[model samples]
Target chain A: MNWLIDFFGNAANWSGSDGIPTRILEHLEFSAAAFLIAAVIAAPLGLLIGHTGRGAFIVVVSANAARALPTLGLLVLVVLLIGVGTVLPVLIPLVVLAVPPILVNTYEGVRGVDADLRDAAYGMGLRGRQVLFKVLTPSALPLILLGLRLSAIQVVSTASVAAFVGLGGLGRFIIDGLATKTYSDVIGGAVLIALLALAVQLGFTLLNRVVVSPGVRQVR
Target chain B: MNDEPLVRWDWIARNWDNGGPSAIKTLLESHVVMALLPVVFGLLIALPLGVACARWRWLYQPTAGLMNVVYSLPSLVLFSIFLSVTGLTQSTVIIPLTFFTLAVLIPAVVDGLGSVPEHVRQSAVAMGFRPLRRLLQVELPVAVPVVLGGLRVATVSSISLVSVGALIGQGGLGNLFIDGWQRQFYTPIVVGIVLIVLLAVLSDGLLVLAQRLLTPWSRARRRTA
Candidate 1:
């Protein structure tokens, strides 16, 4: 416990590229980038399938299969394929890790909305896009947010693991510390990553409360 | 290293059994043991805890909250923390992995139990079945599909994560990734991924088969619905 305080309190650990602040930025950068990319690709596709009720079998099967992929193995393999010392290899696997939860959750969320509500919107003379956006999206907002939150947390944690392959993040502390046999560095890195994940979890929870409508929220 | 093909059958054959600790066979065995133990142990522990959570409404939230926190922490962090106490051993890997399995399984157990219809429980009570007998004989049997669903997730994730243990030098097939990366050889890394995925898929398939066999009635109800 004292080592944790000493590790953080030391002024030297706070200023360079090796510093805590820079690592946190790098960690958040990759996590956010990967998550956004996944959302862009997955969320719309999920919504389309959910609304049209088409190709769901493919989406669900692939998502579940993706869950079984080993993060470290995928990271290493991608790094090896693309050659290391670049950000793409690290980002690729994190994006892969982020996609399944978002895709599946979004698909399930939109599909789970009341069919009658969708019909009511269509009957009111709303076009396809409007019905999807106005009717289904709001009704499915909670689950979509839940999916995003799950993806974000998973991405954050895996991003740290990606540091093992020489990407810049808080995980550098753990990898470097482990390499140098410095226990304090390892512990400090582990603590910081855990704290970051918890922050992501809390952020999403707060976002859920703010973004989800009260009527929709009560249904949950 | 750049000149070498992506995979060398010769290298795989030669290193298949040099009698070293990092042999493919040895690593595969270690990986299976480390990955499976946690799922087995986690199920054992989660069943009662989940039942309790389901039985006592208040216990569900706190237990689920704690498990979520545990799940949120990356496996690497948990591995590092346990390393200090357990020291570079398989137990270090297995213990943390068990927490992960429990995190997934407990909620599953609780949810599975919850899925039992109120009428079903009432009928059991009306039949004079005690709580324990009712849970084991009636409620639990019905809960099989859901619990097994969670079990499949737990099993697959556990198999995948055991490889991350390699960072601490205990990673089973994960060691292959480290080995390949250090030597700039892609064979081991490729082999490792294939094997791990195969293991996960095989285990998941087995669980699905188990679910079908155990809950034949659930399938019938689904079809009719």
Candidate 2:
């Protein structure tokens, strides 16, 4: 406990390249980059599959297969394959980890929307595009956002692996500290990562409240 | 970027022994032990807790909230925290992994029990079934499919995650990743990834088979529906 206090209270720990703030920034950078790429790849694909109800079996089965992939194994293998000369090694596995939840959630969300709602939109003479965008997207927003939130949090938690590959992140503290037998640094890094995850969870909860329609927000 | 080939069958054959702690076979045994124990323990704990939450309703939200926070914490972080008390043992890995399984399984149990139709409960009672008998013979068996759904997720994730235990020196096949990384040897890393993913898939397949065997009625109902 004293060591934890000392670890946090040190002014030296607060600034510079190896400082807590800098490590946090690196962690967030990795997480955000991976998350954005995963969303771009998965969200639209999930929506289309959900709307058309085609190829969903393949999409979902692949996603589940992807889920069973070990994150640490993937991270190390990628680094070994690509060389850690670029962030791509770190980002590749993080993106892979982040994609399945968003894809599955978004697919389930859109597909789960009531059949009556889709018919009503189509009955209004709306185009397929309008029906998907206006009716399904909004209706599916909660689960879509749930998927995104799950992906975002997962990416944040996993972004620590960047440090294992000699990149910069809070995980550097844990890995470095463990190597040096510095328990305080390991605990400090773990604490910071946990706090960041909680903040992400809260942020999504707030986002859910603000963006989800009043009627749908209460459904969960 | 040395000239080492991506994988060496010779290395694998040489290292795979039950003789030493560093042997791939030993690491694999420990990995299986570390991974499976948590799901078994978590299921044991979560069943009653989940039933209580489902029966009480009010307990569900807080329990779920706590579990979500637990789930959000990185496996590495959890491993480190447990290091203080468990001190670099398999228990350190198993304990946190159990929390993770609980986070997923509790919800599955709650939802599974909740899925039992009200009319089903009434019919069970009307059939003069005791509360214990009604729960075990009626509600739980019906909940098997949904509970198995959650169990599959828990099982696969657990198998994959046990590798992360390597940082604290408890990572089963995860040790291969660290060994490969430190030595810049691709063989162990490739082998580790292949084995861990294989383990996850095989375990998941077993669970799916268990679900099919346990809940034969579920498939029949789905077909009719």
Candidate 3:
């Protein structure tokens, strides 16, 4: 359709605008920051919760509840509290969104470890921490990596919500296009988001191959 | 005794006087109505599609792969595509949402059918039941729980994603949130968020209740505290 051509033609024009690259970088930067922070906080807590077997229910329920909160609402609320344009607006909600998959996967992975193998570890007089690190962690790596893959994909998709707060990303194109009724810009932005999602998914698949042991992968 | 108005409460009071309550009700009603149609339609289409997919391995892989792509694309992006192609309207929302539901439900239905015990299918055939009768009589009952689980996920996702329809001027809870954002009013945003969360939880709970009612045989395994 002529509309499609016009849209693509206009999108090409916007490529020269500095906002495009800045928006893309800011989006990635926010997503990466949120993911790293969440991984740091969640991975260890997941390990602790899984090892102890206490509070597993509480952690998972809380995380799921948190994930269910509308990202836009959270972004607005955080912006209200912290004021707009700070990185916190983007970071906090993503951390909340990213946590559930990571925690669930870690807990499930650790809990899923063969009971006999764990018993063997314990029978060797390994302390709780020793067993967790030496026995549980390595064995649970594949599942935990799966969780990380899921979390990364989620974070990538969600990071676009940052554009709602006037923080920049591929969402900027979509939002701006909507306002102006520009179809091509909207499609361009969407294509970029989809591409980003695919890239993240593929990235995790590669990471899963490297980080997950073949023996563990086969078990599942 | 305190007369000082809370900013949050004051925002709500002003909006309430401005017909916010009616707006909220309309929004809730619209959301339920919009979400229900796609869910029903998608389930109807997906059930047979899934069974067919399960039966034919060649069709299974391509259909499943396409569904995965549909699942991964953001709801807003889907809405935008629909809007541009069809022009903004309820059809845009309904069509894409239905497609999205099918994307999830079909795979789930296929998985559910596949999960039915091999022996059960074999026995149905042994008894001389035709393929259709066997599917309906044997596989469907067993597959109900798994299919319902997928429906539950799809339903919740649909409810949330339907809010994106508000972007194109379709009135729903998402409209409240967006209007609040434009007006810089926090109350409508809060009300919208609370309403959506409530809708999701309530609907999911209802689905679970339905699962229990429909699958009484599975109830014996339910943990009794």
Candidate 4:
């Protein structure tokens, strides 16, 4: 317990590239990048499939296939193919991890929208894109937020795995500690990741309260 | 590229035993067994808890929240935490995975029980049935699909996660991964991915089959109606 406080209190642990704060920043950067890429790819695609009532096959199969992929295996394989020390190797798997829930949830959320509401939107002075972004996306916000919550925690947790490739992240603590037999470092790393994941979950819950429409939440 | 295939097909062919067994085969078997053990334990542990949650209603939120936190922790990190407590062995892998699966399975089972139609429970009560019998015979069978859905996710994801056990020098097919990565060969990596995916899909299909077998009345009634 004192070791933990001592570890944190060391002024050396608070600054520069090798510091705790830097590692945390690196982790957040990777996680944020992965989340943005995943959202950009998955959300619109999910909306398209959900809105048009098409591409169900892709969503179902891809989600299953994506879930089944071994994260470590995928990570190393990408690194092997792309050569090491690049962001793509780590980011690709993280993106893959984030994609399925977002895509599936967004698709289901949009597809499950009340048909009458959609028709009502169309009957009003709205066009197709407006109908989608305004009517369907708003209606699907709860589930979209649900997917985002899932992805946020997933990325935050998985960002630790990035340490395996000698990248900078909270994962570095665990991987390096394991190699050096530093029990405190390993425990600290694991605790930090657990706390980070929980924080991400709480943050999203708060975000949901603020971002999601009250009507949607009430329905939920 | 020097006539070397992207993957060494010849390696796979040579490794194939004459309808007997092989190293990869053993790796796969252990991989599968380790993955399934957690799900088996999780189901056993969760069933009673889930039933209690359904009956009490109050237990659901806190337990689910706790489980969600468990679910969010990365498996490798969990295994590392356990390594300190349990020492370097399968216990390290099993304890974390069992908890992780429980995190998801408890919610599924509880919700499944909750989803049993109100009229069905009412009719069971009216028929002079006791709670235990009604749970086993009436409610459980009706809840099979929903429970199985959660089980399928747990089983498949757990299979991928057991690969994290490789870091501890324990997971089955995952060993091939460490071996291949160290050697800088592509074959074992490909083999590991294929076998892991195959195992997950097969396990999922088996659960689906179990659901079908357990809930025949649900399907039959729908079909006949």
DockQ of each: 0.72, 0.76, 0.37, 0.64
Q: Model 3, stretches more than 4 Å misplaced?
A: A1-17, A120-127, B1-22, B126-128, B220-225
lDDT of 1 by residue, A46-164 (tens): 89999889999968786777777888888988888888777887888888888888888888989998888988998999999999999899999988988898889889889888888
Clashing pairs in 1: B166-B171
The global Cα lDDT (0 to 1) of model 3 is 0.77
Pick by lDDT: 1 or 2, better one? 1
Candidate 3 structure, TM-score to reference:
0.87
Clash totals in order? 1, 2, 0, 0
lDDT of 1 by residue, B35-119 (tens): 9999999999999999999999999999999999999889999999898889999999999999999999999999999899999
| Predicted candidate 2 versus true structure: per-residue lDDT over B1-225, tens digit per residue | 668998999999999994888999999899999999999999999999999999899999999999989998989999999998799789999999999999999999999999999999999999999998998999999999889889988988899889888988899999999999888899999888888888888998898899889888878989999
Candidate 4 per-residue lDDT over residues A114-152, each given as its tens digit: 999989999998998999999899999989888888877
Runs of candidate 4 with Cα error greater than 4 angstroms are A2-6, A9-11, A123-125, B1-4, B13-22
Query: Top model by DockQ, which number?
Result: 2
Locate the minimum summed-lDDT window of 10 residues in model 2 chain A. Answer: A58-67
Colliding pairs, model 3: none
Model 2 docking grade: medium
Residue B184's lDDT within candidate 3 is: 66
Query: What is model 2's interface RMSD?
Result: 1.1
Lowest lDDT 10-mer window, candidate 1 chain A?
A58-67
- The model with the greater lDDT, 1 or 4, is 1
Order by DockQ, highest first: 2, 1, 4, 3
For residue A208, model 3's alpha carbon misses the true position, in angstroms, by 2.1
